[model samples]
Target: SKITDLEQREKAQYDEITSLKAQRDSMFLDNQASQEKDRDFLKQKISDLETRCKAAESEKSSLKFEIEKEKAKLNYERDHLESIKSEMQETINKLMKKNEQLIA
Candidate 1:
């Protein structure tokens, strides 16, 4: 009778161990699924950031081109003004020489 009782207790302990193993397996699967979700979220965030960076680079290039064009226009205007000033100075000198002759 005592041997039979020990055998029953051993069988009960084996069943409990099996149940615990199944519970641990389920928890492991749940953690794996959660990690996959987090990885996907981070990937999408990185892709969005890359797109924004490209758009900003394009806008910066366009602004730089516009600034260069404005600088060229300013240079042309400055050269033209300098030429006009030179011609006016030469005309004044001619007029002064003529006035001196008339007075003499």
Candidate 2:
């Protein structure tokens, strides 16, 4: 009777150990799945950030181009106005010389 009780106790202990090992394995798998989800989430975020950065860079380039074009237009207008002023001055000088000759 003593031997039989000892054998039963050993069997129960072995069963308990197996149960605990199964629970540990389940927890480990759950942890691995959680880590995988986090990794995927981070990867998606990085991709989104990269896309935004590209868009910002493109916009900056476009704005710079527009600024340069506007500057060129302003320069052209300034030069055109200067040329008109020079022509008007020459006409005035010619008219003054003619008037002086007539008076003399």
Candidate 3:
């Protein structure tokens, strides 16, 4: 009778250990799956950010080109105005000289 009791106690302990091992393995698998999902989400987010960065770079390049074109246009306009101002000064001088001669 004592031998039977000892066998039963041993079997109960063995069953409990097996159940604990299975629980531990299940928890480990769940953690691994969670980490994999997080990694995939981060990868997708990084890809989207890279795409947006490329688009912003393209837009900045286009804006720089437009600014350079505007600078060239402004320079050309300033030079043209300078030429007109010089011609007007020459005409004014001529008119003043003719007026002086008439007064004399």
Candidate 4:
């Protein structure tokens, strides 16, 4: 009777150990799945950010080109105005000299 009781107790303990192991393995698998989902989410976020960064860079380059073109146009207009002003001044000086000769 004593040996039989000891055998039954050993079987119960063995079953308990097996149940505990199954629970541990299930928890580990759940944790691994959660980590995989997190990694995927982070990768997608990084891709989106990279796309936005590229678009921003392209816009910046385009705006810079437009600004440079405008600056060139402004410089050309200023130079043309200066040339016209010089021509007008020369005409005025010649007219004044002619008037002085006629008066004398």
Give TM-scores for every candidate, taking all chains together and pairing residue i with residue i: 0.76, 0.80, 0.88, 0.84
True-structure Cα RMSD, model 1: 2.4
Best by TM-score: 3
Q: Can you write out model 1's per-residue Cα lDDT over 1-104, one digit (the tens) per residue?
A: 99999999999989999989999999999999999999999999999999999999999999999999999999999999999999999999999999999999
Q: For residues 1-104, could you state the per-residue lDDT of candidate 3 as single tens digits?
A: 99999999999999999999999999999999999999999999999999999999999999999999999999999999999999999999999999999999
lDDT of 2 by residue, 24-44 (tens): 999999999999999999999
What is the TM-score ranking, best to worst? 3, 4, 2, 1
Query: After superposing candidate 2, which stretches have Cα over 4 Å from the reference?
Result: 95-104
Report the number of clashing residue pairs per model. 0, 0, 0, 0
**Model 4 per-residue lDDT tens digits across residues 4-84:** 999999999999999999999999999999999999999999999999999999999999999999999999999999999
Off by over 4 Å in 3: none
By lDDT, who's the top model here?
Answer: 3
Tell me the whole-model lDDT of each prediction, alpha carbons only.
Answer: 0.94, 0.98, 0.99, 0.98
The true-versus-predicted C-alpha distance at residue 90 of model 4, in Å, is 1.6
- Candidate 2 has what TM-score? 0.80
Better of 1 and 2 by lDDT: 2
lDDT, residue 36, candidate 3:
100
Which 10-residue window of candidate 4 scores lowest in summed lDDT?
2-11
